[model samples]
Target: MAETVFATLTTELVHTRAWPSGHELETVVFSPIKGFCGPRRRHGRLGNVSPDAYEKTRHESLTHS
Candidate 1:
């Protein structure tokens, strides 16, 4: 999951060059848990939603529950 996220973000950076002109690219790896369960659940739940919809749903879930 971390690999997939890194690869996806890296590809986007390469293609879009979205960062500031003089900024350096840095990668940060965060491991909150030892297994894939959390990532799998998040991916499964959020994967099909469009980004805008996902944000709305996520915000509501976090705020309400």
Candidate 2:
């Protein structure tokens, strides 16, 4: 799954940018990766909800039960 996502990202970046330097590529890549992997980013694996929200819901369910 990780490999697939990264491969897709790499393909998209290469197609969009003509020729990016190492620093420029790093800058462009970091933001999306940070957001995508961050808690606030919604995930399909988590029923299309953010990780924070999913964790909160799970905690609430466990506590309530």
Candidate 3:
């Protein structure tokens, strides 16, 4: 997983004519990491859906019961 993500990021960064400054680069790198580690990240254990989507679906099911 990490290798795949790194490869994709590397490919993207290589194509860019301009890169972010030091501080901005930090933000750019961590933002996606943060999202990938948070509730919004897709989970294979959750049938490949994001945690937010899984929660919303579960909630709706309970509410409609």
- Please write out the lDDT profile of model 1 over residues 1-65, one tens digit for every residue: 97998798668755565544433443222233323333333544577655556787889999998
- Which has the higher TM-score value, candidate number 1 or candidate number 3? 3
Better of 2 and 3 by TM-score: 2
Candidate 2 lDDT score at position 51: 94
lDDT of 2 by residue, 1-65 (tens): 98998899888885676765888878787877787778798999999999999999999999999
Candidate 2, superposed: residue stretches over 4 Å from native: 1-32
Model 3: residues with Cα > 4 Å off, grouped in runs: 1-32
lDDT score, candidate 3: 0.80
- Provide the overall lDDT of each model, using Cα atoms, as 2-decimal numbers: 0.56, 0.86, 0.80
Model 1's number of clashes is: 0
Query: Where is model 1 poorest over a 10-residue stretch in terms of lDDT?
Result: 26-35
lDDT for model 1: 0.56
Q: Which ten residues in a row have the lowest lDDT in candidate 2?
A: 13-22
Please state the error at residue 29 of candidate 1 in Å: 32
Put down candidate 3 lDDT per residue, 1-65, tens digits, no spaces. 98998898778864464665667766787888787776787889999888889999999999999
Q: How close is candidate 2 to the true structure, as a TM-score?
A: 0.47
